[model samples]
Target: MSRICKPYAAIRTFLLLLCGWVPLLTALGAAGQTRIYDIRYGNNAIGTLETKQETTGSTRRITLKSRVQMKLLSRMEVDIFAEYRHNVLHAAKATRLQGKSSADSKETSTEKSANGYTVIRKGERSILHHARITYCVSDLYFTEPREIRQVYSETLGVLLPLKLAADKRYELTMPDGKRSYYRYEKGKLKEVEISHALGKAFFTAREGA
Candidate 1:
């Protein structure tokens, strides 16, 4: 992979998490919903993002998968799975892979603890001593943040501040200073514009979906 594409692994992970891309009707079930969104660069289609949510009794499980090929040069893929109980995060894992055959990989994991949660990344361990993680990045795909002010980023293993614009749009500023905008229509995510390491991209809802 080129040095330029190498730095994008982190940024792409964040962008994929922030945007919900799929142009299909939601498949509802007794346990959860499955949705997909299309990832684009300008007018060019580049990738897809899929999210699945399931519930069992009091536990809720969410999984997100994304694949992107930028300029036909490098490809990056990320998958995240999280479980929450009673609106509190219990455990989560996120994996990122880069290259044509997915030769390079990195992982971050979180687990509930007595106080807060334990985070492990690249084999190093850390601790987050906050209370409970009620809302996370994954929830953005399924629900609009009307009254939410903050959310936990499972990829970054940190809490990110979320703002509601006067236009009813949601805005998020990453730690690296990149900004992303999300718009919803009929309580569903319709569009997301994001600034990333490779410039700007968008995830828009597919028409007739």
Candidate 2:
């Protein structure tokens, strides 16, 4: 990881928590819907700024025919076809290949993706690796970004600031005006509260967006 990319990676981990635990909130619907967000925060020569958000509307449920792109290296690209449901997952043509980050100590495995999509084992009971896909490639030759989403049902309602009951309530923190705050509650969540340095913000899902 480059000095500049470390912070983004850290924030990406935070996003994993934010989205990974959303369903654990007791206030959530049994099989309502889930959001896989891509939120990030970091500091660079530009300055200190905070930006975090979750995928809204559609695009949350990557279904059987879902396919996304991954740029491997400069002038190179690989595609990721996501097919997941409940727990079991399978990739069409995913394979192990080396990457710039292949040499990194944190790398668990190397996957050379041509047209082959990768596989993610079923649920927390299965493999720990949820499948990491290289996102983009550039002339700068940076480590390609990957997505990590792990499911832990037993972990539900165990950790603080995490869940309520059976999809009852959930909590999270993100960039507000000045500072961000964690919002959590009990019972059905009519709305969610997000705290800021000055005050707080409330959000309600659109009826059917």
Candidate 3:
């Protein structure tokens, strides 16, 4: 009877350990997954964007890479990296490369401090209060579908207010009163329509990719 009980108890402990680790493994797998999107403008394929997130314990990192060509003349590329702890962003960096040669590039970095944040762009420095920062080039709605009323723009260096619709659409009104709309389908972002001085441009995510 003692021998049988010993084996049973060992098996029970193993089972408990397996059960405890299953969810953690699944969460790690999900964090490592990547999503790619093809950007288009007026029936023409412009570029592609890839986004991924990594998590280790309570720390998370999100990265975005995008490359786009403009009318066969010059190409532009952008890379953004963001780090978060417990869902709050603590650091971020963005780099932009312009022209076909990629020689004309600019980099911007930000770090959070006890009081606020420090930003350095193209050798210029600035300080920000305790504000949440967001990148205008990246599609943040894809990762966080929650209704975000306002977001801080790292590029523009200001906080922008957004309007939300019942259909899971987000509208950002520019300082000049121009409006940009982000439409989602079934909680996933599908399209972004922008009305600006250049014209109305649409960015639709490729389906089944």
Highest lDDT model number = 1
Mark the 10 consecutive residues where model 3 has the least summed lDDT.
Answer: 13-22
What is the TM-score of each predicted model, taking all chains together? 0.84, 0.25, 0.73
Q: Give one digit per residue, the lDDT tens place, for model 1 in 136-162.
A: 877788777767788888777888888
Residue 73: error of model 3 in Å? Answer: 1.9
Expressed as tens digits, the lDDT of each residue in 94-151 for candidate 2 is: 1112234433212111222343322232222223233422111110011111121222
What order do candidates take by TM-score, descending? 1, 3, 2
Rate residue 66 of model 3 by lDDT: 71
Residue 81 displacement in candidate 1 (angstroms): 0.4
Q: Give the winner by TM-score: 2 or 3.
A: 3
In model 2, which range of ten residues has the least summed lDDT? Answer: 136-145
- By lDDT: ranked, best first: 1, 3, 2
Error of 2 at 66 (Å): 20
Please give the clash total of every predicted structure, in order: 6, 19, 0
